[model samples]
Target chain A: MPLSRVRIVLIATSHPGNIGAAARAMKNMCLDKLVLVRPRLFPHEGATARASGAGELLENARCVDSLEEAVTGCRLVIGASARLRTITWPLMTPRETAQKVVSHYDETDVALVFGREHSGLTNEELDLCHYLVNIPTNPDFSSLNLAMAVQLLAYEVLLASEEVTPASQQGQLPAEVEKFEGFVQHLEQTLTDIDFSDPRKSDKLIRKLRRFFMRAAPDDEELNLLRGILSAAQGRKSMRRDETSKE
Target chain B: MPLSRVRIVLIATSHPGNIGAAARAMKNMCLDKLVLVRPRLFPHEGATARASGAGELLENARCVDSLEEAVTGCRLVIGASARLRTITWPLMTPRETAQKVVSHYDETDVALVFGREHSGLTNEELDLCHYLVNIPTNPDFSSLNLAMAVQLLAYEVLLASEEVTPASQQGQLPAEVEKFEGFVQHLEQTLTDIDFSDPRKSDKLIRKLRRFFMRAAPDDEELNLLRGILSAAQGRKSMRRDETSKE
Candidate 1:
């Protein structure tokens, strides 16, 4: 019933500041129970500065050497990751995981786990959970911080616990800005490579091209498919240009 | 139900980019309704520039002058602020606010209010809200960037809607990384509410706390339930602090 009871654990956090930020994130969402496993550098300056005033979470935090011990009694364990693995588990978003926890509100404890900043949760760590929580970033570059993963999951959990009967209109899910940006960047690079972009007007041309996609409002899956097509087109363009340039 | 249709309002924002970012934040959370009340700048070049692909939120954002007008028919109004004023509104943390808003989910409209970054809401403005949403931050410095405030509320709305349950569990349910970071920030705010974390030691404790929770690998529902408890506790603390300071 209280955010304080839901335990949140971080594993091998390298930067203390990120740890602080992660605490800040949980506190922002009203989650308080915190546990750490084998952190590299804790009780450091960056964290508190980053944590700002949400430092109380840090004071009561429990640190352990092993992840298994961190979540011993937990009825549900959600592993946060940037990438998907071959490991078999009920994959759930942080939101779904939160719902699972709520469904078992009868359970005494629940856990939301994250991994090191550099590599994220290991397969062994991810396998420990009943479900895998992924943040779904651009596949080409999906490195997310520990705190960020927590914040997203926390936000969803809060909403699920609410009483509102949603109007339930599935609005058009928009394209992710990061993914759109990535696709645009790739397209820009591709255009430049094909000599289709005149250096003088390339910036304007690229902006216009970006605008075209932005207007379309493609979501993640759509954006990915668009990028794939563009990449293929650009690849063909590259071959033709290379042949002509050599000749 | 679904998170796609939450109405997010920003009052008296100063920066256009923040507006743009707020739009991006809403999009990240899957909350598309963005209403602005007398932002210092809107249809702002910098804001749109920063919004990246969330231009649609900007394009569709409803601009108004009075807070009442922005939320006239709303069944619920939750205000965002880092500072507590002498006058009180029913206080709630962002997570609690999200829950409260959703409780009114059957209503045609729900508005989560955010004030300017500099001063937050005035007593008159707070009066218009059914609830006051306090973002717990560093006691010494608790000001969140306007976009960050928007991100927190938007993330909660989005999480409340769809992040909790995804059709597929193999990947993260399409939430933006930056928005997730905002939730982390709000989590940190909670410790500030407890007033136990000294500024000097705040950073270390906060990071350790993040380390603790991030390691838990919470799912969306678990994270929300945790945050909801913490946010409610902070809201009580925030209201209490305001009462004492006023006397």
Candidate 2:
């Protein structure tokens, strides 16, 4: 019952195979409920074969005449977006939106709606959602496959529902605050000692370094190893200073 | 040069529009490297139209006869998978996989290979990959549009390489391990106090809860609020226990 509460709605899907693929994507994530609005083709051989083992989901999919009818009675509606619209709406990242949907799983019916393969959701269709769900994609190449978007969002939903767990973190640990802070302090001191940055004017340099490390997201051992390198640099600088002073 | 080093290889793609769409997706993410292996049609009107502003990418796209030729010198090769096979290869989620690809960006060539529109990569073709990348999707319905997968993975590459910043995190910070672990311990204690899980046999439940929160990835403030809720629940449970003892 809760599974059915989370509905995957595809509007004006042009390719029957994609509709089947979308159904398969939903099924892969243990989602059975699918709603198709004005799809160009359904009950097609291509869709059935593409669905593979997920043909049952396609068989049970609700094909509606309109977006309005597809999402009727749904208390929470989320439209997946690709581009920034002329009219901006409240937008949540796919991860955040999936959590919201899963959290409200018991209380209300939720619709995760997708637009056509070519144009994506129209402004009018997007207006019906409580908020938009935008997958953080490459700005230069933001075109996502219709089924891939469904797969990503549905994966998040499955994850939020605690139906699945990632294999493991593979022994890599996230950098802790203390370790990260230590690395930053070590890097700053090394830079200052080496005259790479003047201590008094290192604010901007420090900010750049912070951004670099944050983007890299080094693990604990990696941070420790880097700190070792910085310490060695500091030692080398001090040794050079000693020689220059003696001369 | 690193951007050029990361190649998008489509093996035997069928539709001209998908090829165009794939090019658009690559351009949106700032990726210029595209290799088509034995596509059904190329230089078609439909592909040109779908490419839209990314015509430059399609113009420079390389058409190769074999996957080996497309990825000949790539030091790292990754294949995208929608289904599991008998022999499991080392798999990475799209996010982790993208991070790996980006980390190697400056050093050597990398390839992100996707299969055909109908039947995906064959076992023989997949053997060429160093590892497999699986986008977690609905187990029942794991159909992903090829271009969309490219977009999401390319987006991660951009993020990891610091080529682009997300629009914003809306003030939510990434959770440190200490904070995450603290929240987990609090949740487990509350669950125990409320008799939600038997204290002795709660290891599996606790593990599941951990996965749920980890996937949800609530920021520090959100974690604090959740911890507060757990504390309140524990307090209420203690009060109830005291009343029952008195009775």
Candidate 3:
């Protein structure tokens, strides 16, 4: 819900589909507020069709004639730029911008302003911004689609928001050390039974396998599954031994 | 360039414009390899117009009949999924996936696969992937445009690729996809032969095993060791069968 305080402002956008796509991208990232300044077209079918399930955002978007009007209530304004300007401005990467927005979300409303698809924000439009955010791209082909740019920034914001939240560690808990060691022992025993390794000379091989599985950091369930497979392999070897003894 | 080793694959894309936009997005991120699997429309004007300055990518894009053909020669295969599946697979965030790709760039060819625009990837298609990458989105409105998804992922890859240094490259190279598949098949046969699993009912178990091994990311030498163990296990089973027949 912290993203509610952040507003996405598009300046003089030419393509209606870009506007719709931007709205969809914003909604996907949990940011809702949208302001269009001097859009060439709005309420067009192209926009509606492209918005998909995010039509509500376009319906609730505010239209303003000037950049100042669009960002009037914002305490912090960040301008998105693809080009490295000659003029001195506090430049930030998308991740830095997201961090700034997240840290300031409780204190103030933030505005992230994007520019025209072809020309981008003019000097006067950029002067109103406290910082300029640039998405790094290949130097030769630096042109990113307007909506795609929105998607990238919004994604960074979403990730940043999750990091700051208390419940960010949602992944499964890793297995305890004892349980993991047991699995390693089982693996080593199975390897020996299958004649894949000799107990005296298999230390290096076991160590390598240990390092790899340690990096994977399997959870309890994964560890149990692994132990089951080792048992199955061992079970096969014992069954073979019984048949040979009977012979 | 490390990114040159990364391929962007789109399967059964519906919109031509999305294809063009995806090409542009890839070019912007310095990734050029593109393979399309059964796109609904290609060589269309909509895609050409959307590609803008990146028309060359669209022109050079390889069109294939299936995902297998599209991902041929890749060592690592990562599938992008919007919906969280009931069956557990090793899931990675876009940033983590990007780091993985960049780290493995020196050792292997990587493929990032995206599925249909409306339905996304099928479970069977996902079975072929080593990992599932979920782009975090608002739970209520999780819909993300195909091109926009491609853009965000490519953006993250570009950033991660820039952060990696040559000295960071360590560890053994992973086995090729074909070899990995062969090993999986061998393990399945061994499991059946050992009477531990029935081929008809072991899909879920095999998938779990696949997920675990994929997370461990075994290299050629490690995979060879694993396959050797499977062969040894199968040898015991076949020997037991022969002894029983003689009795």
Candidate 4:
């Protein structure tokens, strides 16, 4: 519900595909509100094709003639800019901006604005924004795709929201220490049965193996499977010895 | 330099524009190594047009025939998956995977593999990966664009690389995928020799074992030790067979 308070606004977008892609990106991060200001083309086949499963977002999007009109009801305005302007404005990274939006979700209707594909936001358009959000990039090549910028910011917002919520713990329970030690003992015996190491000199190798497996933190099922493999391997040698004695 | 060591591998990508867009995203993040495995089309105008200023990466991209070849010589492989698989690989969020790669930057050449646009990586391809990374999305509509996935991951890698200090070295270098595969092959043969499971029906068990070991992520030395043990076990059985033949 906090994410729903954050709206994504695109100003004078040239590519319809970017608009659709942005919509899909927004939906992927659970943000549905979209405002487009004088986009060069909308309701085009390219936009629909790129929207994939998010065509409904496109159909529900509000279109306006100007940035001012787009942010009419928004309580907070943040502009996404690629480069710093001569007149400095408060700039925050995407993560910082996401935190700001989520923390202020209850009190504010937030509008996160993006600009055109080529020139980005104009000085006048940026002036309307209370703060600027910049996604860090290599100085030499900062041409981030329009939709990608949306994806990154939306992703950060989703992460921030999730952080506020209690996380669900999944995955199997780890193997008990005693059981782990039993597996280790079985592994050592199997190594000796195969003559891979003399028991006295194999301490370091066994320790290294132990350390490696310890990093994995295998669960009970995995440990049992490992023990079974060791048993099968050791059983083969014993069976072979029995046959040789019979001969 | 650490970021340079991170390679983005796209498997069976269908669109050239996505490839181009991915290159631009990587360049923006200061990552340039691009490996394409069985792409539908390359060097196309759509890709170049989409690449914008980062066309040089596309021109210099490495095209490979298989995923194995794509990840050759890499010390770590992480697959990007949209949904959780039935047999869960070690799952990490993009940020966590980025942290792992950056912390291990000194000793590891990392490969981040993205699967096809529609269906993600096959279980076989995933078996080759040490970890699976999922970009958290809205479950109702989790359709993430291919290049957008690349952008999100590359962005995280860039952020993590920037956070790396001079003294962040953390673990032993993981074994190269090629050598890891060799150990797995040797392991399968050893299992058959030991009569642990019929070769024809051991697929699921082998996958389970592979998943367990892949989670451990042994280094080159540890991998060699595993192979040595397998060989020792096989050698003992061969010796018994030879004695029986002589008799």
Which one wins on TM-score? 4
- lDDT by residue (tens digit), candidate 4, B16-65: 98998999989999999999999999879989998989988998899999
Q: Pick the candidate with the highest DockQ.
A: 4
What is every candidate's C-alpha DockQ against the true complex, given to 2 decimals? Answer: 0.04, 0.10, 0.44, 0.47
**Alpha-carbon DockQ of candidate 3:** 0.44
lDDT of 2 at A171: 33
Which of 2 and 3 is ahead in lDDT? 3
Measured over all alpha carbons after superposition, the RMSD of each candidate to the real structure, in angstroms, is 25.7, 20.1, 4.6, 4.0
lDDT tens readout by residue for model 2, A51-132: 8688898889999988899999899999998887767688898779988998898899999999998898877787799989
Estimate, for each residue in A1-247, the C-alpha lDDT of model 3 and write its tens digit. Answer: 6288899999999999999999999999999999999899998889999999999999999999999999997899999999999989999999999999999988998999999999999989998999999999999999889998898999889989998533213256679999999999989998877666669988988998898788678889989877766777776333212233211
Candidate 3 lDDT over residue span B142-174, tens digit each: 878999889988988999889855465547666
Task: Please list the C-alpha lDDT of all candidates, in the order they appear.
Answer: 0.63, 0.71, 0.85, 0.85
| TM-score for each predicted model, relative to the true structure | 0.44, 0.56, 0.87, 0.92
* TM-score of model 3 vs. true structure: 0.87
lDDT of 1 at A161: 48
TM-score, ranked from best to worst: 4, 3, 2, 1
Candidate 2 regions exceeding 4 Å error are: A12-21, A38-56, A65-68, A86-88, A115-127, A138-148, A162-164, A168-247, B12-21, B38-56, B82-89, B115-128, B138-152, B158-247
Model 1, span B1-247: residue lDDT tens: 2254467888888878668766766665556788899988779798887676678878988889888899977777777767776664567777677776666677658888887767888778888877788865534445655666677665555445543544354333323445445556766674444343335556765564454344333445444434443443443322212233211
Task: Please provide, for model 2 over B6-121, each residue's C-alpha lDDT reduced to its tens digit, 9 standing for 90 to 100.
Answer: 89999998878778877876776678899999999998887897676789888998999988688776656788887765443556877777777766665568899999977889
- Residue A221 in candidate 2, Cα distance off native in Å: 30
Worst 10 residues of 1 chain A by lDDT: A238-247
Question: Per-residue lDDT tens digits of candidate 4, residues A10-84?
Answer: 988999999999999999999999999999998899999999999999999999999999898788999999886
